[model samples]
Target: MWSGELLDLDAYLARIGYDGPVGEDGELRPDLGTLYAVHRAHTGAIAFENLDVLLGRPVELGVKALEDKLVHGRRGGYCYEQNSLLAAALERIGFEVSGRGARNRTRGDTLLAVTHAVLVVTVDGEPWLCDAGFGHQGPREPVPLARPGAEVVQGEWTYAVREEEEGILALSILREGIWRDLYAFSPQRYHPVDYVLLNHYSSTHPRSVFVARVIVQHPGDSVHHPVRRALVGRELNRLHADGRVERRSVEPDELLALLDREFGLRLSGRDAEELVRINRAGD
Candidate 1:
């Protein structure tokens, strides 16, 4: 049973600039077609961002709130907001979408404690993992859940599914030929409130990377810097766009300025100096 309102399929598609009607089979549409549609909606319309933290706004998990942000505000959100919103939309369109959570092992065992969100969909009797809310764009193809060899390639990221311990499944990705942890979760039941707790920690906890820095995604690339003003060494840093990766030092004020000029983000109530101090310590 759906927890909230049934999403308006036409309006949702319109929100993302799709003029076509929802197919009769609902979300069992052509896999490649659906993948393209999702990509277009996510990349062309929404602005992947993290301005809420800077503006002192709590990231809410309600469907209405997510619709307001994604459809009205024309913004991109973190995992909780993104995956929940996508799941709701898919459900309305007739896809068997479920809200699931995962552990982000890439950040280390300590950071792995928090639960992250993902969406699962079934198409043509096959389980497909779909995530348009991830900061980077999604795979050009749907990731088959039942097959060990299922894979999708997008630029430098190759995503695949593999069985993990205790019969639980894992989602692994190859970044530059090295397999790394993206997230891990199963079909265990989940609720919006469950995400609220993790969302709070991700946005406010002293140890959260988002609390210490700001991240903004542009059309074809993204930029990350400490939320405060201090300089922290980037674990893996590369700025690529227009066929080149520019390695440059971004100052506190300049970072703020770029937030407005490039990413269409205008922040308020954020203490830039404080952020810098926190960032310096992490560095």
Candidate 2:
């Protein structure tokens, strides 16, 4: 049904080391479950970061661009880049996946516009939210699109759903049970160009975190590693095994090593040097 040649699911899965599937009920099974598997595989596999921005590269949405960046480059991506690649992977695996746009509530009024490129997948005739691009603080499992108050806790963060007007859904997380809006999304169909617009805003806007700072996220077996950089300096925080907080400052050169060693994002030595320079300047 797709116009382009379909992606190879096995190869894609193998590239990311995903082996999960869906069950007979059409829900995501342990081996090949669609939404659950996407979450499990994504958090377990791809990291969330803005290295492209730090490296002064453009983030594109075309399929080849995604494959080249994700599979070939072996790097992590933010929402549009990661989710777009994921949609292709889901489509290849025989799941009905569609692209959707969202507004980042965290940025509030500062951001020039909303962000695009999340996925909605159907499993057992039900829709589930599967996003792997929201960094370390995204949903750990596929959440039901229609279920309000549904929650999933990953490490210290807990994701919950709330319904809003106009058929929109707000995804929130309890940072100590206080609801924080992650983003508001609708199950609307979006063209790749729609994502291009949002991508441009995120990458170019003055107030955007993408342009203003460096963001990194890598997930472990039971913890999440997140770091942020701004004029105030860089902050490195870890979501520990027992859900404790740990914060520290890492050297700029060390940041590159952390990305590769801890987060599994490999960069060339030149890229690493550039990242260190940019991060140092931001400090």
Candidate 3:
């Protein structure tokens, strides 16, 4: 159950740089074409980031907070925040949408917890997988859910969905000439409270990776995307989309400037200083 009236659809579309056709009544066009356009625009405009977690700032999953931070503040967020915002916008636009949780299997063989969030949207009676949260490796468009082994290609990227078990689906991406499992999930629908718990564990748990370092990611320009990971006051690793990565030592003095310039983060002097201090302490 979503409070659709609370979401400003126009603001969300504007924030994502989507200028697609809104109906005469000022509602978003509820069709597959519009969904693809919106998904691409969202992935391109908004970024996948976790700066707040690293800075010890509370990551609120509520709709109003998401609108303020991601839309008005011109900031980026991780999976929960990103997908949650997208889901709300879709619901407001009259699309049938539901939240699904998945285990992030990109790292290794071990089955991780259900820490990722994705959206399953039905357009014209067919279900499509729409995810705007997964940084560079994310799909730029919706993938058909009916086809068991369908490959969806967007620009230079290629993704696939395969049936892993009776009701489980495995999403994989082509990386280095290999198909890698990105995540796996069932058809079980999740609620806002479920994501709240996941977000809490991710943002606050000691073993959670979000607290260990600063990870800022944005869809790249043309042929090159960038993922900036910093150990604050130590080293900053910039991974490019062209497979060329550059690593450089970072001093505390230059952290603020780096975040502002490279990650497009708008931070006050006090906020910057506090983030730098936190990163140095490795808390």
Candidate 4:
């Protein structure tokens, strides 16, 4: 149960800039069109960031907490927060949404823990991968589960999910004429409590990448021209839809400005100062 009833649907819709036709009861239809619209609108509006981890704060997965920080507070969050809010909104709108934990394969070939959170939505009796949390290189719209291994093009990007060894499905992006694996997952469904454990390790573990880096990503938009800008630690990379990657290093003085100007993340004065200090330490 995603506790979708507890979510303020109006505020959530407004936050993502998705204005759907509402009925007399203010309900949007549960269909593929709504799913695609919400998925695109959410990713385009909210950024993906780990400022709380960098600020030495805990990441809460509760729907209310997510609404407070992400929806009301106008801040961005990493996977758990992103998809949890998405799940709540979709469930509230009457879509059958389930959680799936995926092993992030972008890092390397060695088998890593299933730390990434993705969603499987059932629409018209078919499963579709709806993920709003995989950062800049993630899909802009839902990928059909029924059409696995078939190329689905969204704007300038192309994605396909291939059947991997042992019932695993790997989502890949076509980059520079190569189908590079982004992540893979099994059929096991995860509960809200499951994410609590994963969130703990991600935000607290000393060796966890989020605990070690200041990561913020913007997967661009219509007005922004579909250019993905990802700032990991000190490196700022701009990935174009045409596969052009513009890289640069972020100076301590340039940190806050870059976060606001590039990723649309505006931290408070205190958070900004602390982030600058951390950047200066180069940790």
lDDT of candidates 1 onward, in order: 0.59, 0.69, 0.79, 0.90
Return whichever of 2 and 4 wins on lDDT: 4
Off by over 4 Å in 1: 1-11, 19-32, 108-111, 137-141, 155-157, 218-246, 260-283
User: Candidate 3 lDDT (Cα, whole model)?
Assistant: 0.79
lDDT of candidate 1 over 1-283, digit per residue (tens): 3343555555567766763334676543545457446644644455555556645678877787887777776666777777777777666555676667777766666556746777777777777777655554333335778886566564444678887777566777665456666677866866667778888888888877666555555333311221111122332224332223434566554655655555454444545555444434544
- Candidate with better TM-score, 3 vs 4: 4
Best by lDDT: 4
Candidate 1 has which clashing residue pairs, if any? 212-227, 213-226, 213-227, 228-275, 228-276, 229-275, 229-276, 230-276
Q: How far is candidate 1 from the true structure (C-alpha RMSD, Å)?
A: 5.8
Q: Put down candidate 4 lDDT per residue, 73-189, tens digits, no spaces.
A: 989999999999999999999999999999999977888999999999999999999998999998889999887789998888889999877889999999989999999999899
What lDDT does model 4 reach?
Answer: 0.90
Shift in Å, residue 26, candidate 1: 12
Per-candidate clashes, comma-separated: 8, 12, 0, 0
lDDT of 2 by residue, 112-187 (tens): 2457467787777777788878765676667777677777665555678798889888898776547788888875
lDDT of 2: 0.69
Error of 1 at 129 (Å): 1.1
Which regions of candidate 4 are displaced past 4 Å?
21-25
Model 3 residue 43 CA deviation (Å) reads: 1.2
In model 3, what lDDT does residue 71 have?
Answer: 94
